[model samples]
Target: MQHLETMPRGLPKAVKKCLEKSRDSALLAVETYNKPAIKFKSGGYIVLMVISWTALFHAIFFRQKKKPFYKKNNRFEKKDGDYCYWELSTCVSKYFVADTNNPIRKNLEFFIPLRNMVEHKSIPEIDSDIFAECQAMLLNYDKIMLKEFGNKYCLRESLSFALQLYPSSKSLNNAIIANPSTKPIVDFIKAYRSGITTDIMNSGEYSFKAFLIQVANHQTKNTLPIQFVAYDKLDDTQKTNVNRVAALVKNKFVQVPVTNKDLLKPSVVVKKVQTALGNPKINKNGKEKDKFNMDTHTRCWKKYQVRPENGNENPELTKPEYCVYDQPNDTYLYTEDWSDYLIEEMAKEDEYNSLYE
Candidate 1:
């Protein structure tokens, strides 16, 4: 509960400013998120948290870089003229020694796509659906903040439990049914969660697990207001039996809808692009060749960085959200959305110059 009433004089000014901003933004985010009056705008809370966390990382990177923190062509910069100091995603990759499965990274991945989707659109169910992840995000922030700065700078005490609104199976079910417009959000959440491993999904650091308890009113003021009894607080049998409570929340959401017919193979993707682009041809190595061939499609995929790299063996890659990998057939699966993206990107070059003219 140490208060940073004033910026310590000895520390670098940039580091101080960045850390201060980060702390402020984090507090604002949690405050905004928990306030029911502005529940509709709670998605903005994630954006703020991202900004705050990004700044905190930048401060760390800057401190680690020390004297040359502002020097040109450092790891934080792309070129002499191009700087990536303020970019969150780039900073995470450069500073944090984390993998794709890291809890912080995983949580960020969930939020990043979500933030993109709900940027302008008022997705009503986002706050309710992402409750666990949002709780974990704040918890992670405080832990990392303490680890990075020190216990003195941690904000754990400032954050309290976000009391459950409806903490029973029937209530939760009714809430889901009443909010039918959230179907798309529910589908996206399921598709994304389905792609992640069970360990990651079940990890409290990745997504906080809340077990609803009906507490009796305390007449004595000396009784604890709210207590966080960790797993260790429970005996071995209780620990093993906790699965019963977890089952209450597990697989309760709508499963991702299966659309088995729309998937297309690489050859089909190429053919579709070629037909859409007027079946044009280009001069290859001493010979004229179809411009929209498999090679061309491969080049396009790499250029645009279509995620879940083609032919990746990761089981999650075949989830049919972005693309699916057929195990037995040994082929990559793509959808109509991917086809449209390819055609749209290829059309910009417009190999058939006559059409633009």
Candidate 2:
């Protein structure tokens, strides 16, 4: 599924530390729950079941309707992106709760029952490993929840702007090793946590760019699979050649009139060897051929021009010039790759780096 494509990678240090702490807490919950712990009687297990099931359902169906600013009817509508990020944040919170009334507690309440059915479902097959790990994952979610919410601090996007100091000072491995209980959940959370803060520096633009390209590639593959006119199946070299030729025939989108005139110049010219043994002579009238369409002059010309004082209609102007009033009012056309956007991004990166450097 597109939604499950990639988790964030190259995490900020704070997220890494949060992951470690949450992970350790998860392993502790699992170890404690799995062992007939010193406490947590039959009633406690029932409480765990309800909480886990509720959490599981919430994660599975986290979608909800929210009002957006730009609707004509001014109605609230469902948006997947918001739900996904918030739910994931909730999933992280499920690992860190110290008391009741935590939403993450409710999430756990929802998850645990399904986990029991999944693990102990005898008439059919059961997967103890997934069930066990998911339970641990949910526990880690509690740790994040408890740290942020238990003390009256909600760790959702609402507080994302407020957390200036993150846990970057602490080493994730050290935190895990010190805690000892959360190695597995810590590792798992850290793995999923990569995409967590591409939003930290808020540079999801790069991620979003790659995402759009992948989406375009998928759409193209589905609607316009490659077709070769000359060759049924081209080797890599042939494909490269076709691509180059396609690039060569593209029309330029120059805004300046002089530059457009310069581009209109013949890219190539051929001369016949009229005199093999004698000196060459420039032809009085050389016929241009092949490089571009002959009608290019008509298409590129500005519709209106000035008249000469002496009754010469097309005097003085050596090249066809364009005027703002001559062009079609609403005509729009599409061509070219998004390399301009990419180039601008690279320029911004360079500028930012230069500023720091």
Candidate 3:
């Protein structure tokens, strides 16, 4: 384990302290999650890792001689007589200010809200469903540590592949069915996933998904029992071989819910946008009238390019976060994010005017 004494010499005192605390918190998070006896692993790990990430960002800011504390009226905000520090979400926003769509930032954003939702509840059934995101969060932490500091502070040397019993698809399903209370969390996960672009959804930095296949015994006993190969780093031939192997062992345990239970039609989307925006009015031909309607909805989708036009040969090409093509209905369905996005954007006079212009 990297210790305070081993940290780079002549570093700022605040940076050193934050780095040490961050490292310890991350190590504890991994230890907590890997404990075989612990059933509620996700809850503990998320709380600790959020702290770890916040501290790591604090360390980076401190190294650059920047204060990460919240400010009120140009003065540091105080909580219980102590300065209030920026939370993980704020830290991410500050650090990645220039790149809002960064997959790493998205990964952290996913956990920030999730940590709150799971704080007062126990939803162990979600562990397998969100394992990819959890794994990416930890890996992204180590990556940032290496980039900001050096290999000396990296967590790779201190961590190992966690031992695990192969999961049973039937048992996991039964557990989820038994815990009906987890519906909200499960729905949130699905909704959040549906709102992201396919590239971000597939990005390893956002969610590290992999297949663990058993291979034949090595010719030499000195070989490691497990090895991690980067899919992107592989050559074309190697990638093809990996793909073949993955296809052979891949099993679909849980299917994505594709029913139209939550999908909103255009009229419903317009109503949602109107209500969400407080039913604001606009002047049409010198008289007051409803601001948003089907025409506005059509304009919004066209302006945002959420989906192809009605007669377009390829209708499925859409920004999944807001819109999706429903083949059976020969129409585009909208997600909750679509209305929410319209509410936010069209709230501005300039954006609302642009849709018409």
Candidate 4:
């Protein structure tokens, strides 16, 4: 990573300042996380990393000659006479506008709400549970920095593996059990994880999961003590070998049958959407009526093709994110995302009217 003092003189003034602040913030985040004395590792790390990411996005936008501030009435919004810059969420939206399901974006999104949840409270129990996403966030930050500003701005060299004692298998569970106040945070984490697709959950770009196996020291004294192998980059034979080794230490997981508690009926979805939209009323057949009803929901499902019509031969064909087929009941169930999508799309006058067309 390039030191701030060594930054190129030719770089734009605003971009240089943003980049310098970003790099410093990132370094501070890593320092805080790696410090053995710090008990609030996750909270401190997240707060600093959020600032780092926001500033990094600002630097990128500035490099492209674009302002990264909110505008209203052709004027930049100001706070205390200084221009208000975009937040991390806004930056992510603008940067990845074309791809909503990007794993890197998902990882960042996970932390945005999490940061808020932990702001006023200490929840160190979550550190181990969210390690994968936290690692991926830092890696993604450095990767983007390198891509945008070349090798000179990379953070790889400045960081080292955080030393740690091995944790007991039930440490995370025990921590949460001991702290009843952590239930809300735990629930939030689980709900967020449940909402995302399995593919995104497993994506290394979304969350970096790995096994650290202890092996005998190499013959060469100077050989590196640790190395990271990219599981996705490995050949099939190599993967099989790794899996065989992993099996010896893998924890046995008992499968539990899933319940349909999260799956909502069509009526429930309609009610949720209507309530979310302030229960707007419209004229239907010359009488005032709820604008978003069963018919509207039916039109939405048909228009989005989130699920097949009733009595279709392929009853299981449904979008997992928005809708799912309940085989035993032979009915389509909706997800919270479905209602949220409706609330957003229907909130628009044009989009709501298009349901009729």
Q: Which candidate achieves the best TM-score against the true structure?
A: 3
Q: What is the TM-score of each candidate against the true structure?
A: 0.62, 0.17, 0.73, 0.71
Per-candidate clashes, comma-separated: 0, 37, 0, 0
Cα RMSD, each candidate? 12.0, 28.1, 11.1, 12.1
| Ordered list by TM-score, greatest first | 3, 4, 1, 2
Question: Could you give candidate 2's per-residue lDDT for residues 308-347 as a string of tens digits?
Answer: 2223453433322211111111111111111122223223
- For 1-357, candidate 3 gives per-residue lDDT tens digits of 757888769888899999999999999999999998887799999999999999999999999999999999999999999989999989998999989789998899889888988888887787877888999999999999999999988899999999888853433334459798876666556556655566888899999988887779999999999987888999999999988877666644334334244667788889988888899887889998778989999999998899998899999899988886755236677988888899999889899888766
**Alpha carbon deviation, residue 189, candidate 2 (Å):** 18
Model 1 off-target regions past 4 Å?
A: 1-5, 66-83, 162-164, 167-187, 218-220, 232-235, 245-357
**What are the lDDT figures for the candidates, one per model?**
0.67, 0.30, 0.84, 0.84
Tens digits of lDDT, candidate 1, 217-260: 89998987777767647998898787666665464632323423
- Residue 77's C-alpha lDDT in candidate 4? 98
Clashes of 3: 0
Tally clashes: model 1: 0
Q: List model 4 lDDT by residue over 1-357, tens digit each.
A: 565568988779899999999999999999998887887989999999999999999999999999999998999999999998999999999999989899999899888988888878887777877778889999999989988988878889888888878743444345569788887676556556656677998898899977788888899999899998899899999999999877665644322223234667888899999999999999978999899999999999999999888889997788988986654235677787888899999999999999998
Q: Candidate 2: deviation at residue 77, Å?
A: 5.6
Best-fitting candidate, scored by lDDT: 3
The deviation in Å at residue 223 for candidate 3 is: 1.9
**Could you tell me the lDDT of residue 30 within candidate 1?**
80
Query: lDDT (0-100) at residue 116 of candidate 2?
Result: 43
